[model samples]
Target: MAEFPRNDMATAQDWLRHAVAADAAGDVAVAEQGFLQALLLDAALVDARFGLGVTYFRSARYREAALELRAVMAAGSADAATGILLGKSLYLTGEFPESAKAFELALTSMPLQGDSLRCYARAKTYATMIAGNIADALADYPALAGAEAEPIETVIRDGFGLLSAYGHRDAAAALGQLLITENPDDVVQRHLNDAVAGRAIDHVPASYVEAHFDAFANGFDDKLVNVLGYRVPEQMAELVSRHRTAFDHVLDLGCGTGLAGAHLRPLAGELTGVDLSARMLEQARRRDVYDALTHAEALTHLAAHAATFDLVFAADTLIYFGRLDAVMAAVAEAMTPGGIFAASVETSMHDFEIMPSGRFAHADAYVMRLAEPYFELLERQATDIRLEANTPAKGALFVWRRR
Candidate 1:
């Protein structure tokens, strides 16, 4: 091996100079060793730590890179370049929320363009899907840390809409708790508070679902179809057409705003729709496609109804449920023998996983297992459900038959 600086008596500056030279000459191993030596000689050397972090990052040692970059940040030596590097390191390690904050800081000096900007946007979108993690509000409002509760509450409630929407649950829960304390009947805030506080919930509460869809019923169609490019209903309708041409009776479970009802109407002799949201039912009723629209939960209606339907389909509805045992059993019981069943689900590896976006994705195996006793699998097709955060959300459509 060539002679290299290994003397304990060598000054930190000497090691740092050698490290910089090695780095410039692309001698990664020597550069890393020199940087470590420089940091050992002078623990407070931010330059040495930054150099080590760059070496680690280049070598794809992301966790090590983050440690050194974080140390540089804590040393008050962070600049736009440091922030960008730190952000990239955190992002590669799947710390999207923290990465977003780092990228945001970098934007103060760096031009708002290129990979950094794209990464920031993607990270921010993913961050919003996360819930239950408390945000350090002090970062944005250091002065408010010691301020009175009244002012903090006011700020969160009145002016922190963007922060709350960004999955900063602590700020949102603070505001929600304040609102709930003042008005006991604020169901919306109560539900939001429960969700962010780690309350046990197998599925979204019916009241919450009703209120949510009711509030959005007016713009639901335009938002899903035009803005989000939602095509699950159209895809589901096509799936049904391939397996069967028509049915004497059809049930559209959780038929929201009549999106699926309109498509299924042509194939049904008598179509019935059921939903938890009355506002959604009102919108569905406007289509005049269903012979009957029942304002009730899908499972409740399914449990009560006899085996009269020859076709049952739910388009873009199963995402609210983390467990399909109860609903699947109810659907199985409600359908006539040899009847068709079709539905769509966001896909995951787990039997079922509650996503950060407050939706559930089920493994294909789980769905097949649930339907095995009651139905024969006809077809399973994977496709993009919709645009979430400007990215295609992958999901599967399943068609089955009652045993």
Candidate 2:
């Protein structure tokens, strides 16, 4: 084993060399530590900061990467490469407007790079659409059309159309039209069909959920609580408090940003959280609440730690699960006998339905029937989960004890 140099013994240049070598050798975590050590020795070492930023970018810690890269640029240490990376990090963190600006800056140096141009265009489109700025997004259509080949252009057009239609509350018709242009055997088209018809798909794709939350991670707390009026986490905490004041071990399933953990910390001797998004886990780590936080899919994490938790809570987490059978079974296996499980679901008339927003809604009967065999319902009630497009979104909250 090689002994690494201590921060006090090594100069910033020495640390920079080692960090660069480590990064090129694909030991990014080590490279990040090395870069941090270099920065400690010399705070203004541009190479050290840039190396750390790139390491964070590679690790998919986009928010951290963006902050570091922004600092590097503000200090006048930026180049085309740094600008490109900063743009990518911003885009990954859902800061689309800023991402577009960063990409555009990169283009000033590398003007003819197709990849940069495409990324810039995509960022602008997503920024406009997500902010509900339809006219601005449509205004760029002509330029976007000229940039891509026919097939890619058509997909982009349809994607924008779907976003526009969904914004206008006509998602079903727009989805149908998009599917008509797509190959019948395409998996996404099939999923769109199921979503449009209000039928549950086999299951929500893990990739989709991971990407969605990963992008939303940076602003998740503000977007959920302030912008969307989300309160499921607090509601779950309150419901659990009424039943049992304390738990030996608690699991926060899909614990995005540790919101539930913040509320449930007092009730738990040990708190563990799991989510599919690494970026979301990063945010949760900042809360300093959970004893352990794992970046893993919910069922996979539960299976690995079966029968370990006395209580499990998932606030607004089940929306990503189009079907509940497998997940419910997994939770049952993961819980100790008589363990409590509290969860929330968007309301649906059918047993389960996939909405145009790509979330699942479960009927009250569906939740009750599924859990009846393995758990006993302690409490179930209808509640307003959040505000969607200036309207309250109705949902059901339930607390069940494992049988």
Candidate 3:
């Protein structure tokens, strides 16, 4: 009843074919048993071994699959095709370097084999991510060498550069390593990340905003006022009323449509506003609330004109920054000793701390952490800012004295 010649171990080959067919048809259990049956008869069967390994892989039994494929390689049956597949199995089990070695073997045998080449390239990329500068130092092999380097390699390198710079020496230095002097573009992407990271930000003025705000400028206030529940101006007025004698000049960071201006109109001896969106500034300009309007990266602009404000107010600007050190440090330098800094942030209770998400729902512990180094917390009022993108945005109003 065996599907083979009943001699010469022909049953092994027939069972292996049945396993492969059943596996292709997605009958994993039957395929696994058939592959096992084939291997029982012919212990030297590489096809049945590999088939069983793949079946374990499809069943999400990555450890078992890895064990089997590792045996295949140990048995010296790892050709280019089998080596690449085995490397993938190792990668699934989180053995990255071992996976890379397998991919390297496949690529070494068939250097231009498309699948092998791609897998090999990706394995190296994964190693770079885990190792950082250590990996870069060890990998003396130029990642993008030769005129024939694949376009995908550059993208992977750029992403690595961004991640590296975020935590590494500096993103700029990482970019230097990743830099392709041929036209040498891609600097802007790193700058964008740097800006978002609360590092030195280079403001790249976009013309799109001129048109964007040009269209929305007229009704901008009405939108924020009515739709967004933008009580920034109103809330600011209340804070200023309570601390009216604290400061003489106010620098409104990210002042949109002069909402802060109207609130501090009575308190500000002079008012200046900064925003990335020129269209938003255009709307703010109409209200005559600011003595000056500058289109610059908000913190850079603040740092350039430091110690000028008796009070520096930012409502909802901290959301863009994951860390508050740079902005708060700038505020400390920009304010006179004991100058008051009042602002609104998204705040939440997180393990008894104010976290970064204060722009939405964040730990109050992270909020307090941001406030501690730069300013002494005076008063904080928790309130709902308004619905944004169909969801309500929560906020906290804090008054601090710059230390």
Best by TM-score: 1
Predicted candidate 3 versus true structure: per-residue lDDT over 9-87, tens digit per residue: 5688888887888887788998998889899998889888888988987876766887777778888987776677777
Answer with 2 or 3, whichever has the higher TM-score: 2
Model 1 Cα RMSD, Å? 12.3
Using TM-score as the measure, what is the rank order of every candidate, best first? 1, 2, 3
Cα displacement (angstroms), candidate 1, residue 11, comes to 55
lDDT of 1 at 292: 95
Q: On residues 1-403, what C-alpha lDDT tens digit does candidate 1 reach at each position?
A: 3346667678888899999999998999999998999888899999999999999999877778989999999998799999998898886665668988888888788764566665565455445534333344423332322222224445445322333434555555665676788878866556666765546666767877888889989999999998778999878889989989899999999998989877898899999999999998999999988999999999989989879889998898888877889888999889999999999999989888655455677899998998898999999999999865444689999999899
Worst-scoring 10-residue span by lDDT in model 2: 164-173
Which pairs clash in model 1? Answer: none
Candidate 2 lDDT, 139-247, residue by residue in tens: 7745863564235445444553444324432333443455556655454445555565656375778776677678889999998888778988988899988999889
Per the 3 Å backbone cut-off, how many clashing residue pairs does candidate 2 have? 1
Residue ranges of candidate 2 with Cα displaced over 4 Å? 1-200
